[model samples]
Target: MPEFKTEPYITDSHHHLSHQDFSSDIEEVIGRAREAGVEILIEGGGEVALPYYLKNCLSDPYLRNMYFCAGLHPHDAMNFSDSILDKLRSLATHKRFAGVGECGLDYHYDNSPRDVQKRVFRKHIELASELKKPLAIHARKSYRDVFGILEDEGVPEAGVLFHCFSGGDEDLARILEMDGYISIGGVLTFPNAVRTREVISSVPRERLLIETDAPYLAPQNVRGKRNEPSYIRYVADELANLWGLPVEDVYFITTYNARVFFNIDIDHGGDIVYKLGDRLYLNVTNRCTNRCSFCIRNFRDGLGGYYLKLRVEPTPDEVIKAIGIPGEYEEIVFCGYGEPLIRYDLVREVARYIKERGGRVRVNTNGIARLYHGVDAIEYVSNYVDVFSISLNATNGEEYNRICRPLYKGAYKEVLKSIERAKSLNKEVRVSFVESSGADLTGAEDMAEALGVSVR
Candidate 1:
């Protein structure tokens, strides 16, 4: 955390603290924000709050950098009242007043007439322009119309945050060209989330800000439950990982961008993704018997995560506990830096648990479980595991030995023997090759076909 000061400065660029989900423990939520190094909490909402209530909430100094926006949501546009504008005018003059909106079109579920939604959206933008304050917008499935209005009315120079940004490359390009900042949430944590990852990775760090959009879009780690500001770190970590920068640099640039744009200073320190389950990762073992040159753990940072740590290799009970009950994941990968067969009991416990509970499992191996663990390990493991993905980095023994650089003698022969046994198992056994020189691509495929195992 380069901004690794006493506390990381954070500005929660977009959120809806007014939602009912906060009623149970708004103070606890705020406490979590504080603990996570969030200093400023900018509050905004859809047509959710009344103008009068929003005013008092914004006026409270204890709500450090607390702010409000007034707008008729696309769904609530039909119920827009003239008095709401009158109440908003009262707060717009206050210095804490930063923006207007959370208003935009929702073509996916047209809750309000598109024309009515447009009318209300324009009024909010007009209000923002008049106040010279930034505007926070919510646009979805209506980019053309939303941008059309901003262009038509000559949207103010004041900052505009595109909340819940979920668009293709073209949409992002358009918004970036307009000098608009995009706020992202939990969607980035989904498995194989190429689209959101692509958008976040490519977006300029100076123009990027993150939000939990709490009580909604809680993220994959805390999915199917309420979301809060504490989980924003997962978004931060994912973005940091994608950009190939230290989490500290990400915190520095994004938090700064957030404050300047939203006009609030919030702290963002000690944030970590407490929840996990979007990308299925397995920490097979830390004590690898063989030290491959290309092993990821060989790097300094070594793909570290807050929870992705190992004090001592977890026993079967500990590993099973970490895995939780059965059917919670798409794939239970047995591939770790260490050999899966080393902990035969760990696999037996988890595999049995998952088999009885209807879950999918996979084993990424060096294709030599039999020699080390004995022939029976494969017979029993194949009974419970779903997929066995074997690494075939080379086509022959000499190359395999050269590449894997195995410690044990005859490791290559052991790999071939393991593959042969796996082919006869009840699981989908496959051999794979990392693109390498002396890698007989076609010959490997032919060999795989003969072995009755899929080749990648």
Candidate 2:
């Protein structure tokens, strides 16, 4: 029932509007994609007319939402030469150029000799490395050889994306090992794509992106039909189902990933306040006490479509002004890309203001404020903070230290002490444990129970 409230924030990361299939109706296709909420369409697949078609798209109002990549396809590897590389270098300087290639080996068709394919693929790799751009690779039944060539060539410093990836878990592991991203397409919706469904879930959300690979692989609903960017919602739907999230959530996550992949800047000017569902979260600062192994900031700049990497830490007045009508949200939370308590005075001021405005307040913290402030920091903010959600990622100090990597010694003990102080004040409190951190969830729950607080 939860549908996208606006044009769905889908980014068709790999498409081929230059393909002859859309030559007659390209304008209509672009319009339909815009209507469907496809915010971006990264046109790729380096065919002969790709450069000229992309140039036209850049100037076309209907295709303004598109970005492009240029290179030689494996099928035309025989045509690869210095002149083509020179052409690619010139194209790479374009303002709208997002990446280098949709180039790699495709043994499935064998349109070009395997030796030539490998040779040209290496050239593209070297070119992408020299240009410092991400490479959009296409490998079909040649992932083993493709990965081998990449390992030998040294992946581009800008990054690499295995687009329309159909590899198994081992191939995925290799991609991840190389710190590469993989973009899934319509194949995910095929009833027979059990391997993909089972394997893709293991991909870290931050490292994952979605694409339509239009004019090629169409989702089950549009099977055997000419695919276009508008149908990307089907791929999003499948990702949503696999990730057990709302379709809109998949749209935001994948859209954010695509933007980060292509280095698209979203200038919202350092969001002091952001919304997720009905809760308004205050991004008071980008400073955290612990470098948690499972922290989202380690992977991406933003979360839930809001860029939390602040240009400057917001003043208390800035945060309060941003939360114009605090009571409109279910609750105003002091949880952002960083530790709220690190800015304890700011948290206290903003929380007090929200509480007076009939707005409920929650403060999520690593619970090490007492050590930093040399006082009962939890109790200091307890009057205004209605609920305290603290991180209890591990049961004991040793385990906590290993996972959180806090800057201070005895920091884990301080976290436990802070929780005790909150409970003593009779504040509503919950301690959280991250399952993916490989910590003992049962131990954390038992520790929280002994402290008379609920486990989140």
Candidate 3:
């Protein structure tokens, strides 16, 4: 195998490395994975042979980089029993056990009764909840039932992952809405997987994972061959193309996501500058002017994959230093858990630095700067900002006040004024609304149209 020195080290987020097919040369496969720059392997195990593999396999130094998750596969749901659950609970006690699945509904195969699959999948959900481990789910032609069961069972607090995801656009939306992560495999590289490619491209890299599903579903380039962790690069390459990113960016983003999802050790200490796709986002503050009901930080401290809850906000100089070279990214975005305009000075400083260095600058704001800091605030920032992404969030002040709950009265009017002001300056301005918030999307669009700006 050729070495991948230039590519970033990646993780095979889900794989059956312990399957019987690799019994003859498992060690050599690991060696090849290492050679391919695969730094981590998440092994999905739930078969009867797992005990034997655990007893004898983990002693290898290579296995140290491997984490394991165990549960009954949907095909084997018929064999599930309380005793098997007991065995799984025992396995969960293992120091290396990371999650509780590779289990869900697979109606396409029907190897197990549909009812039995649902029941066993619920058990795995409960077990994962009890064990405080994330879930690695398997759903094939069963996304509806799988999502229904998850909603009914109450998704595990630890987290949930859809392994080898092959869902449609609606399914993908539902998964992301629930903050679930999806892992893609070699199927992405298939010429006929047009739907898969389209849906996967819409997924934020922060919510994506790459896997090879070894001994099965090898990529198009190696269609007849047995898949292994080393082939994860093919999946990464496909995802990179779909997301319009460098393959190394996909590797870094997905690997970071996998580590965070599986609760693996990785330094995610409130990143000041974080990369998502080709844009670099600066998390300048955790403070915001409005307490929007749809804000994600209220439920979780992270977005996409990076931790955004800052204990201490970075100085403008510190942020500039963290950014390294501004021109390296497609755009430097002033967006994070908080509204960037809350620190209008920091935005001016950092955006100026980015713009001066031949980089494009975009500010994601709540449009409250004009309300608090006066008209000049927007005018000054407009000088350096290439684009303004303001959150309209609602159709009118009544709805805005109810949904956003801004600290000041007439904040919605100020937001509208800010949008009009930005447009007057010929700034590339777009307004965004949260669909899940019961916000009036059509009204927001009309408002944006009246203001002569685009809606995002």
lDDT of each: 0.69, 0.84, 0.84
Is candidate 1 or 3 superior in TM-score? 3
lDDT by residue for model 3 (1-456), tens: 111122257899888877888888888898899999898888876563485457556666765768888999999999998889889988888877889988999988899999999999999999989988999899999999999999999999988999889989899999988899999999999999999999899887778899998889999999999999899899988988887777877877787788789987543347677776678888888888898887887665665445577767878887887888889889989999887887888889988998899999999888886666565577788899999998888888998998899988889988888888888989999998888887666666677788788998
RMSD of each: 14.2, 4.3, 6.3
User: How many collisions between residues are there in candidate 2?
Assistant: 0
Indicate the worst ten consecutive residues by lDDT in candidate 3.
1-10
TM, every model: 0.55, 0.84, 0.70
lDDT tens digits by residue: candidate 2, 220-308: 99999999999999998889889888787788788878888777655545556666656788887788879998898887778755567
Where does candidate 2 stray beyond 4 Å? Answer: 1-8, 24-28, 48-53, 59-65, 266-280, 304-306, 315-332, 344-360, 370-384, 396-414, 435-442
Give the backbone clash total of model 1: 12
State candidate 2's TM-score.
0.84
lDDT of 2: 0.84
Choose the strongest candidate by lDDT: 2
Comparison by lDDT, 1 against 3, better one: 3
Per-residue lDDT of model 1, residues 202-277, tens digit only: 8977788888887788778878888877778888888878988766556666766766676553323221111123
Which 10-residue span in candidate 2 carries the lowest summed lDDT? 1-10
